[model samples]
Structure formats: C-alpha cells, structure tokens
Target: MSESLLRVVPTVPDWVPAQDAADAAALVVSAMCPGAGELVACRYAEVTFIDQGANFEAVGCPVCTAPLDGDWWQERMDDAYATRFATLDTVTPCCSATVSLNDLEYHWPAAFARFELQVRNPGRGWLSPDEAAQVSTVLGSTVRQVFSHY
Candidate 1:
C-alpha cells in the first residue's frame, strides 16, 4: 500500500534548532494530522534535496515558466550535489535567467533544506496557509510543505 508523507521544510536551506523542528512537527500533528504517527525531525549536515517522491511531475523556469529539459535539470542537480549543495545557482536555458535550483517552479513543490519535519501517513490534506504560517512561526522561518506518496 502506498503511504503519503507531508514534509515541512524551511524556505531557506538553513539550520534550525532541534527543539524548533520538534515544535513545528508537533504543531502539524496536533492541529492537522492527529492520527499521524512516525513524526520525525531531521537535520542534515548540508543542504539536501527534499523531493515529492512519485508525486513529482515537471519542473519549469521560475522566470519564463518554460518547461525545463529533464536532462538539463539532472545535470545541474549533479553539479550541485558535487558541492554538497553548497550552491544551487544556475542559468535557465529558456531565458538565461540566473536563479537558484531551489527557486524553480516544481509541480509538486520540491525544495532544498538542511532541516525537515516529516509526518508519515498524515491522513489529511495539505496544510492551510494559516497552519503553515503557524509552523513557520514556531520554527522562526517561513516554511513550505511537500507532499509525497510512495
């Protein structure tokens, strides 16, 4: 059976205190996915890609909204991974606009982050903007949610 995950990550790929992460996770569970178990907070040594698993559809340039070539995106991802994601800067092939890979328009809202709060089988829809803002307040940073199915 497939399970859904709701991953909350900071808007910027920066670190936050473990307590802050735990508080954010607790907030999401209590206010939204009360039945959700396996809540976890993670902090990576470096920025890492947090994808939406099989939910991913397409990615596009944030500037021109042109559909990005998969091969080109992969190449850029590889280059960034080589540096442990220290940099996500790239030039969009469509408009030659310089932007961060993290800023791309992803269909399922993927992101790069050093910290994440994940709830497995959340049993609820996406968080409301108000709820997300509450989580953001708890974490002291703006947050984005990534829904993943696997």
Candidate 2:
C-alpha cells in the first residue's frame, strides 16, 4: 500500500550538489515508484534536468553535505526521518496503518519535523520517511514563494 515512488542510482557527480552523500540520489530511489505508477504524483523534482542512463537527479545545498562513514549513514537511517532533517529535539513516528496523504499538513507539524515515512502501494517511486519530509520542505517553500501575493 505504498505510493508509486521512483528509484534512481545512488551516486553523486561534480555538478550535483553533495548535500549529505546519503541523500545524493535518494530522490531517484523514490522516483522509481512514481514513474511506474505506484503513488500519486503530488510533486516532482528533476535533478540537473538531465536523465542519466535512466534516473533523474536532485541538487542539495553544500551545507547539507558531509563526509560520510558507514556508522553515520546507518545511524541516520535508523534515526526518525524528521530528526535527521531538522535535528528535532523530539520525534514520534506515525503508525496510522494506512496510506493516506490527507493528514499531511500544509505546514510541517512541529512534533514530526524529523520523522520518516513509507508510502504504501507505489504506482511509481518509494519515498522513505525522510525523503518524504524533504519533499514537503521543497513543496512548501515553492508554494509560499509562488503564492506570496495571495
């Protein structure tokens, strides 16, 4: 019951933003499902506007990047999605037991700022909880900027 998320190769290049190697190609991972029609397409981010062999790419800021070690990657993977992204002081995972984007807030709920999520029955790509959170961040920022006049 996960959303259709996309999957891409996990590698970074000189032109791509190296924000946290872990996230270098995470979006591509999720895109696999969406592209294949597993999840509904709420938003889409194309990295570098170039489709490599198969997958697309996304660019993060330099500040988000860091030299990685196995331990750090595993630890971040273990940590709640929100915690890793926002460095939240507290975290709580949503076990709603169903795939529904209806609950997603227009604004980030302070409590789940750094939590992770797994979309169900992806028609296209698979967005891990943290990747989903980042998706929200991008969507929210874009929405606010575009509709500021409203």
Candidate 3:
C-alpha cells in the first residue's frame, strides 16, 4: 500500500467546532481537486499527538539549499515537538549562512498536522492557494497544505 499523503490542515487558530471542521473538510475534498476521485482517496482524520511523528525523511536549509546534518536534524526535530511554530538558529554547513529551522524544506515523510483533510496516494498532486482560500472561506479559518508519507 502506498503510504504517501498530501494533507490539508487549518492552522488551529482557536478551538473550532467539530461539526464545522468536518463539514469544511468534505467541501474541500469535493471542490479542491477535480481529479482527486481518480487519483486519491479523501478522508477526515482526528489527529492524535502521538501521530505527530516525523513524516519527511530529508530536510534542507532554505537559504543555502544544503542538506541539514545529523546534529541539526536531531535538534530541530526535538524542538518541533516541544514547541508551537518551532524554530532554531544554526549556520548552514554548505555556505555558512545563518538561518532559522523554519527556513528548511522537509522532503518526503514529513508530518505537518494534528488535524487534517487527507488525500491519499496523491501522485504529484497539490492543492493550489486559491483552492486553500476557498476552503478557508468555507471553514472561516486559514487553511494550509502539508505533505507526508508513512
């Protein structure tokens, strides 16, 4: 089974009613991706904190585009779970550029949420910003995309 997923999650601004979130998720699945029916399976999931485990395997410094080393990886991952909007400061190994951990791109296997509208097996698929805005309009909250694999 393919473990890959492309998820849509609202940045939990405050406590959203469960019914509203579910309704918005259904609408997002139906309206966001026309080909989702053929290319992916959509579902709503209740996110558990334990499931916050790392989904992405590789991370690169956004400034220098250098792959982060083990030390940086360990430290960042540790912080990610401990804090909201986790960030770290370190020098890029490739170019010695000072940057924050938030300035990194995580590749496959990255985890991005505690609650999600999951699109399974979305091969090279993405939800556009306009689509996310549509979801936001419906949910009355900001929505963002997160990619991952199991």
The 0-to-1 C-alpha lDDT of every candidate, in the order given, reads 0.86, 0.27, 0.56
| TM-score for predicted model 3 compared with the true structure | 0.56
| Greater-lDDT candidate between 1 and 2 | 1
Report the C-alpha lDDT of model 3 over 19-86, residue by residue, as the tens digit: 76667566666665554533332332432221322564677877767788767677655764465533
- The clash numbers for all candidates, in the given order, read 0, 58, 5
**Model number with the top lDDT:** 1
**1-150: candidate 1 lDDT, tens digit per residue:** 889899988899865556755675566556677878678887888898999999989999999899999899999999999999998999999999999999999998999998888889987878899888888777778888899988
Could you give candidate 2's per-residue lDDT for residues 88-146 as a string of tens digits? 12211332122111112212111111112222334432345565455544333111000
Deviation (Å) of 17 in candidate 3:
6.3
The TM-scores, one per candidate, come to 0.93, 0.20, 0.56
Which stretches in model 3 have alpha-carbon errors above 4 Å? 11-18, 33-57, 63-66, 79-103, 108-111, 122-124
Candidate number of the best TM-score: 1
Q: Determine which window of 10 residues in candidate 2 has minimal summed lDDT.
A: 141-150
